[model samples]
Every structure is written in C-alpha cells, then in structure tokens.
Target chain A: MAQIRLSSISKSIDGLHTLNNVTIEAAAGESVVILGPSGCGKSTLLNILAGLIPPDEGQVIIDGQDWTNRTGRVSYMQQKDLLLPSRTILDNVSIPLVLKGTNTKKSRTLAQQHMEEFGLLGFENYYPRQLSGGMKQRAALLRTYLFASDILLLDEPFASLDAITARKMQIWLKDFAHKHSCTIIFVTHDIEEALLLANRIYVLSARPARVLKEIALDDSANSTMVKEEILSILDSETGDTYN
Target chain B: MKKFINTAKKSSALFTLGLLLLLWEKGVSWYEIPAYILPAPTQILDGLLKHHQLLIYHTSTTLLEAVAGLSLAVILALIIGFLLHNLRVLYTAVYPLLVFSQTIPLIVLAVLLPLWFGWGVLPKIIIIVLVCFFPIVISFLNGLDLVDPDQINLFRSMGATKWATFKMVKLPTALPAFFSGLRISATYSIMAAVISEWVGAQRGLGYYMTLQQKSFAIDQVLGAVVVICVLSFIMVKIVDLLNFLLMPWNRNQLVR
Candidate 1:
C-alpha cells in the first residue's frame, strides 16, 4: 500500500472548470471515496490521478514521491469495465501482465489462479460478451489488481451493475481491500456505497467541484444521522433529495 | 427453420437466374435475332465449352495478374494507412491527394500504364494496384481512425507504448473495417486487371475478348464477359471467407 496525496488539482475541460483546486489524501491500506453529484467532475479527478490527463495545476504524491503526469504507477478501473470483447476472459484478465512483458502462457496461468477469487473460474474460456455485467466488472478488477500498482483509482466501476449485484460487489471489494495492501480511491455517487466502503469520504460540490465536506467513518459509526447529514448537504447543493 | 429458409432463399436466387437465361434463349430464337447482336444462352454455353481449354489458360493469366496486384495493394495500403494514421500531419497533407487520385479514372490510368511500361504484365499489374488500392486505403484509414477512445485511455493508463497499444488494441478493432475495405477492393481488383489487360496484355480475358470481337465471334466475347463476372464474384466470396476466419466476434452479426 502507498499513501496518495493530491495537492490543489485544478482542471478546466472544454472551457468549463471541472476541478477547482481539489485536494485529497488516502493513507496506506485506506479506502477513500469521492462522493459527488453526477457530472461533478469525479471522473475528471480520477483521470488526473491516473495520469491519463495532467491537471492544469496540481501535484500528486504517491508513497512520498512526486508522480505527476506519470502513468502505469497506479492501477485504474474505468466505469465501463472495458473488457476487450474479442479476448477470452482469461486473455482479458492477463492484459496488464502482458503489458508488463510477461509471456501469454505465464500470464494466463497467473490469471487462471485468481479466477476462483474473482468468482469467474469457469468463464475463463468465454469471450467478454458472454459474461454477465457483474462478471465483467469483477474480471476488470482482477486485471487492475494484476497491474501491480500500490494505488488503485476506480471511477464508478460498479455503477452500471444492478443494485443487488453492486451491493454484493461492494462487500466483496471491502473484504478484498482489507486483505490487499493497495490504497483504493473509489469515486461514486451512491451515498450508501460510500458509507459502506470508505474509511474517509469527501462530498464534492456540483460542477467546478470543490470539497464541500469530509466525513470520517473510521469507528463503526454507521448511524442514520450521518446519512441524513450527507443527504441534507447534497440535497441543498443539487436541490434534489435522491442523493 | 432458419436453415430451411436460408436454403430456400439460395434456391430461389438460382431459380430466378435460370428463368432469365431460359427467357433469353426463347426470345432470341422466336425473334430470329442475329447471333452477332446477342447470342442465345445455348450459344454462349456452346462457346464456353468450345474454347474451355483456351479460356482456362487466359483466365489463369488474368487471375494471376489480379491476385498479384491485389496482394501488393493490400500490403501497401496497410503500411501507408498505418503511417498516415500515426502521422496526422502527413495524413492531413496527403489525404486530399488520395481522394483526387481516385477521381482519375481507371481507364485513363490503364491507358497511361501501357505508355509508361509498354506492352507487358507490369503495366497491367500497376494499373490494377492503382485502381484497387483506393478503397483499401480509405477503409483501412477509417478502421484506424475508429479505434475506441476508451480503449486508448485504458492502454495509456497502463503505460503501454504506442506500438503496444496498436498491436494489442487498435489492430483488432480495425480488422472489421480493414476487411470491409478488402471486400470493396476485391471487386475492384479483378475489374482493374481486366481493364488493364484490355489496353495491351497478350493473354487474358480482356485480350481474348478483343480478339473475338474483331472477328465478330459474339458468343466468345459474351463468354469472356461471363468469365470476368464469375471471377469478380469469386473474389468477393474469398474476401468474405477471409473476413469470417479473421474476425470470429463479427460472426454473430453475419447471421442475418
């Protein structure tokens, strides 16, 4: 696990400021969630952290080293799962390993060892299109894990799955995070998911996103009051009660 | 049920072509139309059988020219298309010229080929490459351009090099489009060969047809035209088979 500190990441996309001096930190082995309204630049922030896009002004420090604008140092799981449709599940899961210069035979052997952990053991020979949505996301997560980075940035990874499956994945993810050393930065609009998975949660303001509130849920404080407080703050910001 | 319907559809197509041929034979005989104008189906068939050996030899020569030119065009298109795709500046500067080149008729290019290379296989091969490579280039470029942005992002995040990204992701995605280009270019390949052969080759369907026409052997001329049509159709079929083999995921879409 590595400590990640994002310093004053400001970004403008297509003439609109998306992240306004946004700063956050996740300690080693800690789970941090960026909870925001839809279209509030959560993905933009994750992209900056992933080094896919450099912020107009920012610094990202991972494991006490400045790693701005450098990629492949952190694993990234995008919202869509993004499994290569042409590749079999084993082949898809082996991509990060392959990218790291491992031979296909070795990579598939390594990927196959984790198929049961991913609950995708028998589906290894199937192409991505044959798998259910939940299976694809788990396979994608397995790939991200295999990327071997100490920090993982997940952008709404389970957002497309059905509610039940998403919740089940969250529980599985939390257990996995507890066992793994990587620091996970999860971005989600689901309040319940944030409450369940995060050690610390940052509620971001709509558009030109800045941190509105930071809630620490480290102590077994799964109270209804905390949910109401987060809800009220979000409801005031978006003028909607649904969040 | 699906298999039955497919078989029925194939049979109906054959039946329609057969009926049309029968009508042509009956009409020619009943109207007493001169053989010089449009030969009956039986006459064309007789002509084909009569010159089957000679026709096969010329057909083989023409086929060789088309296959050579088309294979060369594909190799060239792949190399140039990839270079242009990666070098956007070069693509921007040269893409219009490519379009402009397409407007120059194949017939004109065929004429110029003889002047440039003289009466040889080289001129015909060059002309075929020129005509067939356009669609190949365009389709390949389109496929390269259509590489998914998300796929690119994923590759970039993984710190994959540009070449690795192309080899692993872009190439697979571009295959269907490349095959599409191949299909269009396949049709052009044979036509270009025949047209080039028409200008000066000594042994091909084009040369055979010209010699027959000069002697008013309408049946033989029609027979050469039939061979050309069949050859082009076969090219299209071969491309389809290649497409099927190369892209297994796309097979589901071919069901309709």
Candidate 2:
C-alpha cells in the first residue's frame, strides 16, 4: 500500500489554475523528489499532499486510509526554518509531540534522543536567535521528525542555505531517511538536488502544472548520468541550456 | 572593560542630575523668588522629611488604585486582544471605538468618572483603566497578528489545529510586544490615578498636593510632585524587571 498518495488533485488560486489533475503516489519507505522550474506548482502539490492546502478535487490516502482534508497525519517542513524565536532549541524540537498532547517530560526526553542525530544536543538550551542558519534548519528538520509521522513532506527545505551547507544537508538527510525508513516527498527546483538525493524524480511543467516526466534514478549508472538526464529534460521544457 | 564602561555610564547620569539641581538652586537664589512661587530643591527635601508619614499614606492609596486598575486592564486587554486577533469581524467592528475612546480628554474622564461612581477609589481606578487599556490592546493585537505566514504554513502542514498553532506559535511570539505595552501602560496607570485624584478626592498624593497648594505651602507641593515622579519611575522599573524575568532573551540586547 502507498504510504502517501494524491489522486487527481487539482488546486486553483483566485480563479487561475495552479495544479491540474495531478496524481502521484509513494510507497512505504520510498523517497520521491518533485522537480520543476519556478511557478510549476510543485510546492502547491506538496502542500496538498501534506493537507496544509486542500485540493479542489482529489483524494489523498495514507497507509490505505483516506486522509483528504485532514491535518496532522504527515509531517511537513517548509523552506524557511520557522523556528519559534522564544523557544529554546529543545523546546522547538519538542513542539510536535507537545502539539500531539504528549506530556512535557516525555516529549523532552524523546526530543533529546534525536538531538545528537541532528548535531543539536549541546545547543539544546540556546534560543533560535542564537543559532546559525544551518543549525536552525537542522532544528526545524528535527521538529518535523519528532512529530513521528510515517510520511514527510519537505518543501525546498534547503533552498535558502549556502551551497556548501545545502550539499552537507543533502548527504545527512539521505542517511537519516535510510535509517528511519520513512517515506519522503521532497519538492525542489534544483536538478542537482533531485539527482543527488531522490530515488525517483518527477518533472513538472509551468503554471497550471502537470507532471511532464517521472524518471527512475535507481537504474542510472551513477549520479552524474542522472544529473545529465534531468538537466536535459529541464532544458527542453524551459528552452534554456543549463551548464 | 564592560564593567568599567557600565560604571562610567552611571557616573555620567548622576553628574547631569547634579548639574540640573545646582542650576535650579542658583536660579531661585539669584531671582530671590518667594517660597510660594517656587521652593528651592533643599527646601522641598526638608518638606519631604517633615511630611514623610502623611505623604506615604497618600501615596499608598494612589498606588493601590493604580495597581488595581492596571491589573484589571491587563486581563481585559488580553481577552479582547486574543478575541479580536482570531476574529477579523470583531477587530474591524471595535477597533475604531477603541481609538475614539482614547481621543476623549483625560480631564473630562476624571470629571465624568466622579459623577458616575462618586468621589472614591472606584472613580480614580476607572480613570486609570481608561488611560492604560487602549495601548495594551493595540500592541498585543499588532504582535499577535504579526505571526509569520511561513511559520503558520509550517505548522499547518504538520497537521496542527488552529488552536495548537496559536498556543505553540502566536502566543509566545506575541509576549514580547505584550510586555512592552504593559510597561508603557504601567507608567500611564500611575499618572492617570494621580490626575484623577486631583480632580476630586479625600486622599492620595494628588489631593495632598492640592491641599498644600491652596495653603500656599509651595515647598510641600514640590515635595509631593517629586514623590509622584519617583512613584512613576519605580513602577516603570518594576515593569522592566518583570520583562527581564519573563523574556530573558531580550536582556542581552539591552545596551548598558
């Protein structure tokens, strides 16, 4: 059974279509990346899957259960860190459990267990304002994980990071996903990011976006060959060469 | 080095105050002004020492009224602010009324309050509540509404309910601004209480000053004025201390 599925999803804003009849599914523990140019509605589709924004017409099923129009089943992290400024790192990471009605002590202990995994153990007492940009993003990712959902939706989570930090995070996320065995649906504009981290990639066309292609990366010879293919497809759709 | 710089700042502030007192003394002596016109600083200090017990009694009454009024205002403002923040229609409906209430002069409020409630603590308390409530509500609503869209979306995607999002994000973020408004309202509370007492009252520092003024006891009046200033400063300092205790993150940003 698919861990997360969006079938015939359609989203419109102010009478203009943003997503049209989009259908996608990720099996349990599978990692899929959605790739597109700006305004391709990749984020919108992710939002619909996460149940943040309801689709005009569609059904979303998670773990063989219909979850359309429901919230809190999928853990979602946005591009910005969105760490609560007043909360300490530990408190921010523990927010998901707190919202789920866990006792404070239990939630803290649970969050503390994952702090070392994210390299945030020592900075537990630090406020968000005291953290570096990379640390803040890591803390945010930890928050999403602590919610303990079976599926994760990440919308350009590393888009704001410097290139070096983004590369490091990509490696860390891949390792983290493997260890946790959670399905991940990631949205990104960078073909390189999709190539490096995704098991499969879905290319989306511009506004009123529809899926143009779905490339299986597991069969590719190596990362470089996958990158080239994705770049070519993006170039053809955009009509602009990417070096 | 940081400690030395802080000490130097304190010394400079004291020095400026000393200069102002010296000028005040010299002006009074050179002009040979009558004691009734303006008492010298030393004469006012002497009056303060002589009438200390009486001043304390009056001050306690004013402080009680101010504290009670300000406390009630804080509670009302928080409830109203949270409601208006969550409901857009209520905000649009009542926001202009709040602004309009503030434009009505305080003196008019003082006079009207006594007529409605009779000359008592109730009238003075009402005046202070009127003066302090608007700013607290306005600042709190502004802060609560300032919850970032990105943050809201992030929580929404996590399947958080609207109440959960408010509790975890909006409330904590709005606290700094709420405390700021409280601090401002604290000072206003003291001033409003005293001024209302001046319009009509059997007790309070304002009433004491009015009695001294009628008797041409200029030094005593000056002493009462000084006490009022000190009370206001102390309330503001207390609010600052409360802010430090509640929001320690802001303390590091405060310049020495």
| The candidate that achieves the highest lDDT relative to the unseen native structure | 1
Candidate 1 per-residue C-alpha lDDT over B1-256 given as tens digits, one digit per residue, 9 for 90 to 100 = 9999989897998989999999999999999999988899899999999999999999999999999999999999999999999999999999999999877777877888788788889998888888778888898888888877987898888889999999888888888888888898899888888888877788898999889999999999999989999999999999998888877866777664
Residue B24's lDDT in candidate 2:
95
Instruction: Point out the worst 10-residue segment of candidate 2 chain B by lDDT.
Output: B247-256
**Structure candidate 2, residue pairs in collision:** A72-B159
lDDT of 2 by residue, B105-163 (tens): 88988988889899989999888888889888999988898899878977876667888
lDDT of 2 at A71: 72
Model 2: residues with Cα > 4 Å off, grouped in runs: A241-243, B1-6
Candidate maximizing TM-score = 1
lDDT of 1 at B156: 89
What's model 2's TM-score?
0.95
lDDT of 1 by residue, A1-243 (tens): 338999999999999999998989999889999999899999988878888888999898888888888888886887788888778899999999999999999999999999998899899888888889999999999998889646678889999999999999999999888887668999999888998989999999999999989999967686577789898898888797754
Candidate 2 chain A worst ten-residue window by lDDT: A219-228
**Cα lDDT for residue B162, model 1?**
98
